[model samples]
Target chain A: MSHTTLQKKKLIARVSRLKGQMEAVERALEAERPCGEILQLLASVRGALTGLTGEVLDDHLREHVLNAEDDAARAEAVEEISEVLRTYIR
Target chain B: MSHTTLQKKKLIARVSRLKGQMEAVERALEAERPCGEILQLLASVRGALTGLTGEVLDDHLREHVLNAEDDAARAEAVEEISEVLRTYIR
Candidate 1:
């Protein structure tokens, strides 16, 4: 099985929680919650997303980069990860 | 109106898109898509979430900090924002 498939259940759970968090933020906005409270909620969601990203990135490195079959394949995987990271952090 | 309320529709639209992007990521994982493709989807979600965070943070600065009623209130708002940012980037 692929690295992501190995951890699929756990990853999906995290994504579910993130969806809930975003919904909460939406409701808070609908109710006109204070900026401070909303900011706190947003920060929590941001932190959670970052955690999920790190997990998936780790899996990608293991499955695609580290375990790649050849030097050229490894280099290609590295480039793919770099592109994703660039978009992520840009 | 509060800063967030002023932009509530726009903000909620962004959050809805983020939720869709996340759902796409979840679906990709469920289908056991290749790690590289999954990583790209995840990165897009991360980037979208980051953009949403920036919009809300900017609003918070204007509403809670810049327009604070007094020096002490402004200081408190600054601290609150600082705490959120620490968690966000940690």
Candidate 2:
């Protein structure tokens, strides 16, 4: 449902990269790294996660919300999603 | 940079939930739960992660890409994002 069989490898690769980022975060924590450095690493991981999530959400919009026939509606969907992100990401 | 100070608490809450979901996945793995159940739990975790990622991505788009001054450019951003998602989410 999320992706076709052919897409699975690339998708898994992305998740694997995310896992690597998470592991980096864990390593930083384990090493008792400085607060600033740890925070920076955490931010990096967060950004990576955000990127991954955005990819999936965009797919969901195309698959579940967007319409090729309606340009105005498509813009509205973007706006709606943007508004929700403003709330949720915060 | 990612979120204003006022948004930090809620943003942290969302990350906390993600942590909880991840812990559940770990527990399931530790318990050697049935393969099917474990896969389901993984799927649930994946979905949660996707949801989290989507939120932050939306914020980034608004902060880094979208424009109130230009509707056409805004829609183009959406379409471009959609295309990338189609490739990435696969």
* lDDT (C-alpha) at residue A47 in model 2: 59
Provide the clash count, candidate 2: 0
The C-alpha stretches of model 1 lying farther than 4 A from their native spots are: A70-73, A88-90, B88-90
Q: For residues A8-86, could you state the per-residue lDDT of candidate 1 as single tens digits?
A: 8888888889999999999998898877788888888878887888878887788778898789978988998898778
* Backbone-clash count (model 1): 0
Per-residue error (Å), model 2, residue A12: 17
Chain B TM-score, one value per candidate, order as shown: 0.86, 0.64
Clashing pairs in 1: none
Q: For candidate 1, please provide the TM-score of chain A on its own.
A: 0.85
Q: Write the per-residue lDDT of candidate 1 for residues B1-90, one digit (tens) a residue.
A: 778889889888888898898899889879988777888887888778777788778777887788888899789889888988788665
What are the DockQ scores of the candidates, in order?
0.73, 0.04
For candidate 1, give the lDDT: 0.83
- lDDT tens digits, residues B1-90, model 2? 332223445554665665666555455445544323333444455566556556544654674355333676566556645544554454
